[model samples]
Target: MKLLERILKYQIVTSLCVLTLGAVLFYFSVDYLIDREVNKELMRSKAKVSWQLRHINELPVYILQLGDSLQLDQVRYPGQMALVERKLFNEFENEYQPYRQLIFYERVEGAWYRVTISKLLAQRQQLLEAVVMTVTFIVALLLISLLLLNSWLSRRLWRPFYKTLRALDSYQVEKHEVLTFPKQHTVEFEQLNQSVTHFTDRLAATYQNLKEFTENASHEIQTPLAVILSKIEGLFQDESLKESQLVALSEISEAANRLAKLNQALLLLTKIENRQFLAGTEPISLVPIINRKLRDLEDLIEQRGITVKTAIEPTGPVMHPALAEVLVNNLLTNAIRYNVNGGTIDIALNAGKLVVRNTGAPIHIDPELMFERFRKEGTHSASLGLGLALAKTICQVNGQTLTYETDGPWHILTVTW
Candidate 1:
């Protein structure tokens, strides 16, 4: 989830909990306050009745009326004041109404008299309900407003972090381009940008040093390798060499050739890794490349008596031309080199994909390990085993996928983007 969404979720949940608890407390608080006001009114009525008893010297006629709101009764003993809630019947309304009742004793003319006062609470209850609803609505409106305002502010506050993320996504080490971070006011975001800039600087320095080293080492090794091959060729031409000596010389020659090939392959892989091909600047068609390579290998195919089938479609994909050649060459060579006598080589090309299938015995090694450098099956002593690995690296450099699978006696290699 996005950071803003998570923060808002937690805040909203906490606010809702507090509001629920506050609502319960609010209801009871209003109930108590309203009851206190009713009781005060009852005390005032009792005081007025006592004043009347002291002056008038007789029971008031108003107290004798049935259904009157107040009632007075003469008693022999003093009684304390008490308040209660009661359900009383109303003759006019013909229903039970809740009332707040107050009963107290007042001394008048040397005798104690009980006086009772009651007030209907049905109207007051309606008023309290309305007040509660209004308060709740106001609180809900405030909460909603708070959420919206907070969301907007959070998006604005986090804008710098998002900008930094986009920059990081687009950054590529091979490009060697200097990174420039936008100014950020927040301390943490500023620190993050600084750290990323420092890290990229270090990575670029390391890549430059590695590229230099690979090129220098490959060049230095090739010169001595050329000299060794020359001397080995001279030794092969000598007439006085014995049969046992000839075999050893041949083996030495073969080893030198293999070493030369390995050096070239490693250099090519390093170049691909360094993005030195510049294939991105131009578009290359695969149909012509495939046809030319096949033509070049026609003699080898005929020697093995292999049947070649092709279903080529016109495809124009932008990639390194030399790298593209290497990719196709490796795949075709692997297919031909491993095929049985009179085996079939099937090649297909379409938009954004290629598939090469060849008839061969099932590979003993796991198919998943086939792309690892120097991974070989059985006793293919002449094979260097870097072909598939180099091909996979080229595909990855061009933002493509390469996969291998075996079905029965047919080995399949697929390249797709």
Candidate 2:
């Protein structure tokens, strides 16, 4: 979830809970206050009735109405007053409505009289509801306003942080550039910007140093390797060498050759990883590359007496021409090198995908380890096993997928973008 969405979700839930509590409290408070006001009005009606009874020498009947009632009865307790709420059935309305009752005793002409005054509370109840609803509506309106305001403010406040996030997402260590984040007033956002800038600067520096070292080492090692191979070639012309001495020299030559091949493979891998093969700007066809490689290896294919079949549809995938050549060469090399004698090689390309299958013995190694550097099949005894690794690296760098699978007696290597 997005950070702002989570914050908004949490804020809405908390605000609802608070609004519910406040609404309940507001409802009860308005009911209580309205009841107090109603009670005071009822007490004033009682007093006015008492004044009329004392001066006019008759019971006060004007205070009573259709929805209200007053009653006087002789009582033992005097000077006591109380109010209570009750529901009474109205014969005229044919329904029950709430009423407020004021019960009190007063000494009138030396006799104790209990006066009961009851008033219909339907209007007061409506007034209480209106007050509560108005307050709740206002509270809800304020809550909605706060939510909108918070969303707007949060978007504005986090603008700089989001800009920094987008920059970091696209930052590449190989790119020789520094990120320039916008200035932010928030302490946390400023800290994040500083941390990312420092970290990427360090990473770019480290990558540059490592790249220089690999290139230097590869270059330095090549000179010595060439000298050693040349001196060994010179030693081959010495006729005085014994048979055992010749065998020793042959072993040394094989070891040196392997070392040279290993060094070239490592250097190629480093270059692929460093994106050094991105210099070529050409639209290359996989079909042409495949056909050229097949022709180059036609001698070996005929010597092995292998049958080749091709089903190619012309495609133009834009890539570095040299990388494209290396990709096809590695795949074809592995297919030919590891195939059975007089086996079949099938090449298919269409719709931006290429599949090369060769008849070979079932491979027993973990399928996942097949692309690792120095991983080899059991039968390819003289192989260094970096061919498929290099192919996979090239595919990755060029935004393609390389996968290996075993289909019966055929080993299938597929490249797709």
Candidate 3:
């Protein structure tokens, strides 16, 4: 859940608990007050009835207050004075209702009589019921008002936060663009925006410096490497050089070429990992690239006596054309380099997928480990062990899956987009 939603949830739960508890307490409080008042009225009536009984001629018919009835019963002996409450049947309403009665013994004209003042509680019960409904209604209105107000406040108050989040979402480091924000009223949001601006500024500067350094270093290193290879070629053509010296020169030339290839491969891998190449919106078919690469490596395939099979479609994945060529080249070359003589190579390309399976010696360990740079299954002196690693890096940067598996003597490399 979003931060605003979580806050609102906690607020709603807290309000409900407090409102419910308050309502219960207030309801009981009101009921208690009403009961106290009813008891007071009954006591006042008891005093009046006592006076009337003492002077029997002053009042005789009825003396209870409104909604109350007075009753007197003659008895041989007075037992006790007490107050009691019970449910009584009302003749007018034809229903059972609550009543509070004050019972006391009195002596009148040399005879013992019990006096009872009974008060009807139907009105009090109605008042309490009304109170409960009113409290419930008020609480509901309060909750609804709180919810609406909280939602409005949360959106209004946290607007700056969401705005900052959106800015970060669309941020691209390759663009080297620094983030900027309007002034925020909230202190925390303003601080957060300022922090983000500073962070992006630092990141852009660092990326630019690194990119410049990589390009400059590669350019600088390539110049000397070219000179060394050119000099080694000159030494190869020297007529006076002995056979041993020529052999040594050939070895040096080969090592120099390998070093140059390694440098270029590492540079390409670094650039790909840095997202220097951005994929296009549309998927570019790999069939043409696959066919072209196969033609370029046809002579090698024919020399190795390896049979090649291809099942290709026009569909492909979204990627930069240059990176796509490198990816396919590495996969295909790696297959050929490791394949057994007179073996078969199967290539399948469909919508969103490409699979390359080459017959080779069975591998005992995991195929994924081969994706690591300089990790090779067996000693292939000509192999730099970087082909699979470079291909894996390209797929990762382009949001594709490159998986490897071995079945019997066939080594499979699958790329899924």
- Per model, state how many residue pairs clash: 0, 0, 0
Candidate 2 lDDT over 188-271, as tens digits, reads: 999999888888888889889989999999989988999999999999999999999999999998889889988988998998
Error in Å for residue 147 of model 1: 2.6
lDDT of candidate 1 over 1-417, digit per residue (tens): 988889999989988888878887888888888878767766766666667777876656464223437777889997778888899998778999887778888777687888777777787789799979987997799889989998999999989888888888988888885567876889999999888888889888988899999999999999999999999899989999999999999999999999999999999998897887775665577899899999999999999999999998988456878888899999999999989989999999998889999999888878979999998876677789899999999999888899999999999999985
Clashing pairs in 1: none
Candidate 3 lDDT by residue in tens digits, 171-264: 9999999999999888899999999999999999999999998999899989999999999988888899999999899899899899889889
Query: How many clashing residue pairs, candidate 3?
Result: 0
Of the pair 1 and 3, which is ahead by TM-score? 3
Model 1, residue 184: distance off in Å is 3.9
Candidates 2 and 3 compared: the better one by TM-score is 3
Q: What is residue 347's positional error in candidate 2, in angstroms? A: 2.0
Q: What TM-score, to 2 decimals, does candidate 1 have?
A: 0.79
Best by lDDT: 3
Off by over 4 Å in 1: 18-128, 279-283, 364-366
